[model samples]
Target: MACLGFNPAKIRNQNLHYSKPSSKIVPSSKPIKIKPSPSQFSFKLHCLKSNSVSEAPLSPTEPQISEQEEEVDDPASELSFLDPEIDPESITEWELDFCSRPILDIRGKKVWELVVCDSTLSLQYTKFFPNNVINSITLNNAIASISDDLGVPLPEKIRYFRSQMQTIITKASKELGIKPIPSKRERYETVYQRHPGFQKGAKPFLTLDNPFPMDLPDNLFGEKWAFVQLPFSAVQEEVATLKRTFTFGASFDVELLGIEIDDKTLIPGLAVATSRAKPLAAWMNGLEVCSIEADTARGCLYLSVGISTRYIYATYKKTPTTTGEAEAWEAAKKACGGLHFLAIQEDLDSDDCVGFWLLLDLPPPPV
Candidate 1:
């Protein structure tokens, strides 16, 4: 008996031949036909369906978007956005002069303009006291006339004319003697009756024996004593200086006129009726005649040269009497000099009354 040896190469060749021949062989009989169920077909279709819907056609949506866009682009809508930027409060008082002045329309545009000889004068003071501030008024009448031609308002135009007239009068008053007068009123009867040796009929009631002084709490009284008197030639210079400082030449054309000077004898010991009485008397004796009647008529001058006569008098504490008040009225008359004295009345029944008096400068004669 003999053992058989395995042939590895022969076995490998046989396995290769079997694998190759089976892969190449074709089936002899026809394949059986099969059909899928409807459920299975539906499931396959669902899996293949698109995730997102297709957009609608352009015609329907485009017109709506365009109409909405046009509304937002309207001109009126644009104007509404700009309204808040132009607020009136942003304008200042000085700028109001442009509004008050005559408006000029050229090339369909509006503007306010002025011309002045002395620009400095134009820079100060408004047509009204505090409110209507002008940048600078023109001194030249021609320029002002030009402004008028441009349809500027009358009030604004006249302010310049009046200011110039005032300057001239103020200058003339300096050449002549004139002054501002104190305007305080007080009563004399009670004060005089209280005094010793006060006679009902005596000459010069405003003499040293009787004096009207300020009657106010010391704290409220101003340090400068206010006196009532006729202004001297030098007074105009002082007024000009004052105009430069306080009012800025606003009321320069004002004057005092219609002055009537008189001297009367009264009870010598009677207390001076008004705080202004003594100073008024002094002013009457010192008045200078106005050189130019035209200038004098402007009412540019104050009724009296009101100065601080005495600090002590300004701070006096005694209550005023009726006679004392009458005396004060007389003093105002004297201070007014050329101007007639109107009746004096207490403004209020308080210490403040002693400090306030309304002395009107003579009005301009009817034109």
Candidate 2:
């Protein structure tokens, strides 16, 4: 690490600071402690569901309740049956995006819009408001309008990605009795083209030009690191192996992203071994890790996380050997549709991995 030739002080100063709401703050000055789980972190894909098996069949000696009788026995069931509005089962969660768009109204002022879509991407509700009227009261009204529509149900949870809009969005969601989650998923783009700005063939207004990669905190750096990979056939087996032992880090179903990999496909990865595995893994658990990219020109590795934030993971002296690996890693990542992994361990020989993240380089959201 000493010979990596990177200065933490310079990296920190070079970082691009993003603004968040002042009313609420997430304390990131110290490592976040997360309760360890057996499998791993997940993006909570909707395509997967857990099946619960009945523990035991009903005994013949026990009283049998007829389906009709059971409905009559429960008073709450009567009220639910009587009401035809708001089928909660229709939508479990909604992805929301509230931001300024490139389009301007007739008055020539910036237009602000609220977009809401269900997890299945089948239903959407969009409402536009002038800049002056953007607030929790207005947002709450817009959501209520959607819920009041015939057969449209209010979602149990609402997820929004932009941290800058957290305060107002959280307020609106709470007022509507929906749990608000800050997530980094880009599912909101499904309805982007429907926006009026893009309807007339307007050019895309935004592109992700991430800033220079900044070095991670000195203490968090691993003692040693290496580029590694596993055949697609062995990934599930490896995950099952890690589950029986100690493990931490993020993971998601590749099928959730609509990606299909052949058994022979190689999944590129980075493995880091360090004595500070506990804190390093804990810190990574707090991030919405997107992907890792190799910069062979500068002989650096960059990690993209939490919206548009970028960090310098490692740096090495440029050479034919290192350059070849870097290019190969890049090619493999592209072949896998940006699917990759990061593993942290106590040491190279240790059987237990402290951290492992299944990262995806999702395409940028629609401008």
Best TM-score among the predictions, by candidate number = 2
Per-residue lDDT for 101-141 in model 1, tens only?
11112222222222121111211111111112223333233
Q: Residues 1-367, candidate 2, lDDT per residue (tens digit)?
A: 1011011111222232222212211111222222232111121212111111111234789677665543333111101111234354677788787876655554656566666765444455445566788889988887787777525667788877676777898999999899887766532223233322323444433344556677687655776666666666656556665566646676655554566676655677777777788898888877767688889898778987765568888776656655666787777677677777877777655655678777876565554
| TM-scores for all predictions | 0.20, 0.59
**Lowest-sum lDDT 10-residue window in model 2:** 1-10
Which portions of model 1 show Cα errors greater than 4 Å? Answer: 1-230, 245-329, 332-367
Report residue 100 deviation for candidate 2 (angstroms): 5.2
Clash number by candidate, in order: 47, 1
Off by over 4 Å in 2: 1-95, 100-133, 140-159, 163-167, 170-183, 186-197, 200-209, 238-246, 349-351
